[model samples]
Target: MAVDMKTIEHLCSLSKLSYDEEGMEKVMGEMGSIIDLMDEIKSFDLAYDDTKDGNEIRFADTREDVPEESFPTEKLLANAENTDGCYVVPKVVE
Candidate 1:
């Protein structure tokens, strides 16, 4: 698959991005390479054993979840300059 100027322009517009001629050419080349890689990946024959449960096979090495003690709320909020029940921060935007 080839990435043409029209496709690049459309993608740029959709992403709210702008590029110069040189930048566009570079992007087009990179996008073509990515498409070629995807095509190559699609041609691979990926197989999995159906006899075993897929989730059990995939997660066999993972550790079990365990609960632990948490920090006191007062200690967590102690350093705040302005807090009501939580840490206070300055309003960022209008």
Candidate 2:
């Protein structure tokens, strides 16, 4: 799979980002390397036990769900800019 300039441009357009010529080249190189790494990974045959009564085995170390005590609402919201039992922050955009 090739990582081409068209793909990079499309990604940047969707992300609302711009890059200078030099920066674009650098980003292109990094993206190409990441694609190559992904291709290499795709070609590997990972080892996994597939013979468990003809079904794949699952993890058995999961613990039971148990709720625990947590900090009070007042203490939890202490560092917030403003709160009245609900967190609030300065709006940065319209």
TM-scores for every candidate against the unseen true structure: 0.44, 0.45
Error (Å) of candidate 2 at residue 64 is 7.0
**Model 2 weakest lDDT span, ten residues long:** 50-59
- Give me the runs in candidate 1 sitting further than 4 Å from their true place: 44-94
Cα lDDT of model 2 by residue, 1-94, tens digit: 5678899999999999989999999999999998888887776787666564565445575666799888998998998888978998777996
Give a tens-digit lDDT track for model 1, residues 1-94.
8999999999999999989999999999999999888898776797666766555555757777888889998898998898899888988997
Error of 1 at 57 (Å): 23
Per-model tally of clashing residue pairs: 0, 0
> Largest lDDT belongs to which candidate?
1
The Cα local distance difference test for each model comes to: 0.88, 0.84
Model 2 RMSD vs true structure: 5.5
Error of 1 at 63 (Å): 26
Off by more than 4 A, model 2 = 5-24, 45-68, 89-94
